[model samples]
Target chain A: MIGTLVQTPLYQWHVDHGARMVEFAGYSMPIVYTSIVAEHTATRTAATFFDISHMGRLRFDGPDAARFVDHLVTRRTADMPAGRVRYALVTNEEGGVLDDVLVYHLRDGAHASYRLLVVNASNHDKIARWVDVHRRRFDGQVEVSDLTNSWSMLAVQGPNAAELLASLVDCDLASLHYYTAAETRIAGKGGVISRTGYTGEDGFELIVGANAVVDVAKSLMEAGKNLGIVPAGLGCRDTLRLEAGMPLYGHELAEEINPLQAGLEFAVALDKPEFIGRDALVAASERTDVPVRVGVELSGRRIPREGAEVFLPAGASPIGGVTSGTFSPTLQRPIAMAYIDRSHAEVGTELTIDVRGRHEPASVVALPFYRRPSGRESTS
Target chain B: MKPEDLLYATTHEWVHVAADESGGKVATVGISAFAVESLTDLVFIELPEVGRQVKAGESFGEIESVKAVSDVYSPVDGEVIEVNEVLRDDLERLSQDPYEAGWVAKIRMSDEAALAELMDHTAYQKQCADEAH
Candidate 1:
């Protein structure tokens, strides 16, 4: 029998707003509020709110906090300025990704320095144990604590998200650069607001106390109601991120999949002197036969779902399988991300996807099937 | 559309049987409104050819949503007579009017015995409620 699922602080609020609930990562989360396409379009054009409290929040402090964080993830955290957030991967000893996390370096805390790591909810327990095991090897003073239950995260995303949220928060949303965070107040509640998002749009992620999350969410929704703000769910979240070509933890990165093959070379700091999974990633990078992740756009309306085989033109053997697939609301077409033979991972490479026994025509395209007009500038 | 006039398959497909001008029994088939809502975001559909033969309980077509793909099982053994080709271009019809304009296909029944085994509207409603729990 399945264990009881957890509910976020906004669970009742979502139900009252006509959200369709679904079980995801041990949490009873909303999959859609009204319609997936409507919510997805709202996030792209106006503003949308997502209850992301299911994510794990870990806080580290002490003199050795910076050093310990650098050793844990693939990104170079030692030089990360305060109020900055970096997307990084935590890999196992064998170089496989444990989880993709956002490492935020807070400006001030009770300790000498503090670093917060926001991780995937499903991998929370596994990552907590992983951090504990690695902390034993560190020589300096460091303390780690799991703050997942104490905090709730909400993602306010879209082109107008920053402006809409600025009215509700006490921070200077205009001055806040993308990927930078600030300790601020939302609806009179203390929280951390970061100008970061996964929807390939300019947005902010607000992390507030569990008790104050509902009030903050309600306040933001009320303020943005006139601006076409909709409460989004896990369904549109997947499609938005997929349209942006972001790799999900289980879909693109897994216990057996490393960051190198997933086209996340920038996150891995190869120049670092020592780190977990460094050697394994170095070895895997030199291999020619490694399957690389690539985006595929079907020539027709049929979606190439996860685990669907990808085959070379007229070739009998399967080269790879789709990891994540969706009908992009922005593009209004079916797109997918797949791990195909590196030789066939180039843009415009013709291929076929075995969609329910039928080989549908497809072609390899560049990552991120959709990009906003002002999205050319890199946030991270 | 009233569910009382239609027969339902356990797979959630609805069948409307009527006599043509020549007195031959023809079955019009489509998925129920409940199934359409459950699937959500209809994106693509594949229907059987006009001349193809289908068996009761056998998959005759496919429907795809953003996150899932499902097969539309034939409710009674029959030879495909006509297909709702317009649905391939306008999938929203499947959810907007699943009972009338969204009917997937019409078939000339080869085996009438299968129709008796299908459920009525009330029985189907009870089955849906039981599955909800």
Candidate 2:
């Protein structure tokens, strides 16, 4: 069974460093190197590196690149400058989210148009097929290719990410604004560096050739030894993103859950002339009876896991269910995101979570359970 | 108590049987050190209430970490007479002292035959090794 799972370029590095491997999205990825709590603390306080090569990388080029991208994503891409990155969603005809992706427009001087889209590893094959089927309209005017196999990606995140990664790459990372990327050289190899990360902390994600990613990662880890950079796994990645209140594809945004109901209206450009799901999303936005996503914090240490029903004290019927829940290492409490009735989604609204037949007292709170002191960006 | 002296169950619960003040058999139960390590970063543990009758191999309580929830099975057919209330808030005790201070429950045994089916220290160690591989 292990032979069937995909392995990243750093698979041997993770194994040699005592990582506990687990199957994730058909890949044998590191679930934890030591413990989830320790790695989560390191990412919040200092610096940490995560091997994210399993994420899909798709490239779009040719004359109709910008037009083709604007049609697929919900964000407007016509005015996106070179070295700019924007968060967008790809929705189906039913206005259900197909995937949430990062669109990068890094057109060099030589190329007239170039765009890259980073999609979730679990939805990689699905989105690729979706794009392939939709591109028949543009035929010879556009070219789409899968860069996931040829390129490896790594995320270096924390408060010290700018200073730590500066030693490995040949550019000043401090000047890189949030939600922007630049083409750079890492350890003499060409690559692209983006100032974006899933964690709430300040960080950068680098994409380089698959063959040289191992060397680049080793050099960065060696250089960051004094900075206390630890190799984090996907275990902490989920906790970190949950604490930041960012949505996971399967948990928060599913094929049946629309982006409007998930509180991602900022990523959707409804005014765009035409898109795959613009009409359905416009209708879904007017309906107020649909369940909306809200943050819930338990007064006790008991965690409200996925599918745990949410209810009021006077009612026996369930109002909603938890999408994602975890013990936040930063907040030191159990926090969860749930989709509840719009009437009860206000902050400070009292609710009870049925955690495995036990009623736990919880309250609606703000979106993010934890926020950094500074360097916060509102892109996502 | 040393691990070698305690009886083990395949579900990872450790049992120590002794005669109480009334000369009736009472079994002190807790999870093994291996079980505590496997359930890392324990956040919550639901302790079974006292005076509840439980069957052998039946789940009596639940233990949860950030990412997983596991049931703590009763290793013997008994009436639960006492429970560790401290473990409900202080989960670190389970990791620090899984055998002695981390004891989960105390049961008054109605069937002594269930004790004979449990494994000893050496056999339990072999079982853990086999499962690890």
Candidate 3:
């Protein structure tokens, strides 16, 4: 018999609200609250909350904390200012991505600076073990701890997210620039709020104590009930991220896929003097035959699902394969991301996706099939 | 509405037997409500042409949701006589009234004995409940 899946602090809330639960990353999570399209549109127009507690959170504390983090990730985190966050990838020595993570550089104490890392849930154990084995290369001053179980994470995202959250959070939301974090209290509970999101909207991610998160979520929902805030689920989360041109770990980044090929060159700082996967990424960057990820817009209504073969116009052989795809609720068309030969990764390149057995015509388009318009200035 | 007079397929399609203008029996086919609910957020569908022949247990059309795709199978061997082309654009009908207005196709039965393989309303309801667990 299979083992019981872990439940988030908001598990009962989701079920009470008529969410359809599914197993994801060893946890029972909500897949959809209502219709996927409805929830997706609500997030784009107003605000939506997602229970992201299943993601792993790690804390590093010590005199060499900054140095240890700089060695672990691909980005230059040692120089990152306090209260700032950067998206980075943890790669193996061979330049293959193990997981894409968000590194948060919080305030420094007298003896040590603190850094927090948020990683994918499915790779939580693997990443924890990877860090344990690699921290041996650093000085004994650094200490690493897994805080995944102690923290409950929730992301409130959309155009009206700031206004909705400002009513409940004690800190000033206006000063929190994009990709910045601050310690604050919400609904009388201590927490960390960051101006970051995956939905391509101006939003905030609130990390609170696992025991106190339910009250925070309830307060935010009550405050935003009139502002069209709805509780979103994993289904719309997948669609929203896809529309933003974000790459998921399992779908776009894998052990055999390097950062350059995944179009994540921005996250990799090759100028860093020393780091894991730097050499392999440098060599891979000079090579021209690597398959590059590109976005495709179908000429018809047929959705090109993951693992669908992409072929050249009138050609019988496969040229690439789709990584993630969905019927875009915002664009009202079928959009997908695929890894095709570098020669065929140009904008407007004509291609056909073998959706099941039928070949459907499509064209290479720019990444991010949709971008939300920036909202009004924060009300402080 | 659930139709007690219609025969149901194990694949969750309902069939209504009727007489054509020439007094020959024709089977009107549509997917059941359970099938529509399971395939949430219907996006697109491809139906068989009016003159195409279909065999029992063979796929005659396809439907897709945002995350999944499913085949609509024929319950009895016959030639397609008519199709509800309107469902191509208005997919909500599939879930709103799956038995009547959402009927996918009308086929002129080639073998009337094939209806013996289908289940009744009560039997199909029990099967759905059993599969739920």
Candidate 4:
């Protein structure tokens, strides 16, 4: 069912800058501006920014907001202090992931608690309705609102991201810790800046008013020109996240794939007092037969795409399938995320992928095929 | 060779027919410049082997970009005589020089009747323009 696609505030800017537009999640989004490899490299080496305005941003307020949110997600959000953000999962009754989101506890200086949820663009409508349907239990004590159309989000990532953003914002961004956000003024407009990103590098995500986003983007570009910052697109974003071993909603996560199977056990707070998927997750935790997610490195350059079957050299039946795969720009080879039998999920176990008609040699490697050098004081 | 001198298939592959020293009709095939540009950032190309028989409009190879995979169809029916091994390592050449250095395979046509099914350069340009819109 294809509906009319909406455009972001930066659509014209993307077009004027030579972006190749593609329809993504009912929006006309840029798949690339210059090139995927170039944009990916810039984010890994220098600095780059992405227009992440399409992601859903939901806000909940009122005295019972924290409890209502904690009931909806797997993480225990009621205890999150102001200015804190946590990665959490929204799951169905069967413990399958509905969406993986970032829960932000904002410090808005209001008497009632304020919580913000950033969800995947593809699952925006679904999660919004899920939150609405469950809000009835709160008996109007908690208020739910959708801020997706009114706000714009951007991510500036790489090793030099902090240094580049420091010149544009009024606050000392270098002081912001990872997974923490602060209210700051950019181009004379108030916004929220968080030191979090999907890339396996240091970065910050900026959320500003939709009307003021174009100005903010221009200012960031002008300030970052000398630092070699490029405008990246969703194509590189997928590669960047895959290299970081992040679970994409539709790939590693789905209605039938729980967080536990996706290797996101840390995000699921099973110890929480009560939640929608608590019972199923509690049962899943004790089970040892579920296929687990693992990283795979192919010996050849041919990429193994999603749905490609995984097998052993001597086995007649497939063990599992690939969830995501790409020719990693950083690793300079083919890498993938696969869900396979837990017994074969070891770091060095040999496997094979049926890439189209050819069976390519692959090995069960560690997740996060690429990791930035440590000892950098300010990266996540 | 200039694109105007070549013929094209509806699938966006360009065909350049020339007589070899042995007086056999050899067709050098590569994806059109328009196709290469649209399939941005080609990461890998699986070329057909030298001695493979391929039918017209049949998928003879695959070209992979960062986001998608597309089949590279044969524009003429023939036996593949040569494949550009250079593309196996440096896929950028396929996008940079799609009409010349990026040629994927060379085929010795067993029958020339398939040439009638192709479009001339002018007609091919119109087809691309319509699809882009």
Write down the lDDT of every candidate, Cα atoms only.
0.90, 0.90, 0.90, 0.90
Reference-based lDDT, residue A365, model 3: 96
Candidates ranked, most accurate by TM-score first = 1, 4, 3, 2
**Quality class of the docking in candidate 3, CAPRI style:** medium
Output the lDDT of residue A127, model 2: 98
Candidate 4 lDDT over residue span A246-297, tens digit each: 9898999999998998899888888888999999999999988999999999
Q: State the weakest 10-residue window (summed lDDT) of model 3 chain A.
A: A371-380
What's the CA RMSD for each of the models? 1.6, 2.0, 2.3, 1.7
Looking at model 2, give its docking quality level: medium
Encode model 2's per-residue lDDT on A1-380: one tens digit a residue.
Answer: 66899999999999988887888999999888888999999998889999999999999988888889889988897679888999999999889999999999986546566999999999999999999999986545789999999999999998878888887788777668889998888877889999999998889999999999999989888889999899999989999999998999999999898999999999999999988899999999899999999999987888989999999976799999999899988888899999999999999999999988889999999988878876453344
What local lDDT score does residue A351 receive in model 3, on the 0 to 100 scale?
Answer: 98
Report lDDT (Cα) of residue A340, candidate 3: 97
TM-score of chain B of 2: 0.97
Off by over 4 Å in 2: A108-112, A375-380, B121-133
- DockQ of each candidate, alpha-carbon based: 0.63, 0.60, 0.59, 0.61
Comparing candidate 3 with candidate 4, which one achieves the higher DockQ?
4
Best by DockQ: 1
Per-residue accuracy of model 3 over A102-186 as CA lDDT, tens digit each: 9998863342359999999999999999999989866667899998999899999988889898878888988898899977788
The list of candidate 1 runs beyond 4 A from truth reads: A1-3, A109-112, A375-380
Candidate 1: TM-score? 0.97
Query: Candidate 1: deviation at residue A125, Å?
Result: 1.1
